[model samples]
Target: MAYAMLEKFEKYWGDYSTLLAIVIVLDPRYMMVLVRLAFSKLSIPVEVEASIKEIYDTLVKMYKF
Candidate 1:
């Protein structure tokens, strides 16, 4: 399941990356919401949620500046 989600994320990352960047720059709170929704939609496990949160948090912090 995690592998499937990663595959799907990898496929969309190129397209979503720009939008995510923009969101992070303009509004990090929204980026967090988007990340949470994406992960929820992917049915990510609770164990993996921490890593996803970490990644999104980093992205938000990196781009929010």
Candidate 2:
């Protein structure tokens, strides 16, 4: 039961992490802080940094649009 729940969590997290990060950043209270913190916890630091930059740039383009 517990294992199944954890499996579901991992599956959804992997599938929707980018969307979740984008949505969270739309909130002023969180912005990038929470997303950066969460991404920092991931295994790859280099990718984390790149992803952060990409997400920020995407947000900028969104605002400009």
Candidates' TM-scores? 0.36, 0.67
Query: Candidates' lDDT values, in order?
Result: 0.59, 0.79
By TM-score, the best candidate is 2
Per-residue lDDT for 1-65 in model 2, tens only? Answer: 99999788777654336667889999999989988888777536897788898888888888899
Task: State each candidate's clash count.
Answer: 0, 0
Q: Highest lDDT: which candidate?
A: 2
Deviation (Å) of 52 in candidate 2: 0.3
Candidate 1, TM-score vs. the true structure?
0.36
Per-residue lDDT over 1-65 for candidate 1, one digit per residue giving the tens place of the 0 to 100 score: 99999888778652334345345545746655666666566545793476465666766777779
Looking at model 1, the pairs that clash are none
At residue 27, what lDDT does model 1 achieve? 77
Measured with C-alpha atoms, the lDDT of residue 32 in candidate 1 is: 58
The global Cα lDDT (0 to 1) of model 1 is: 0.59
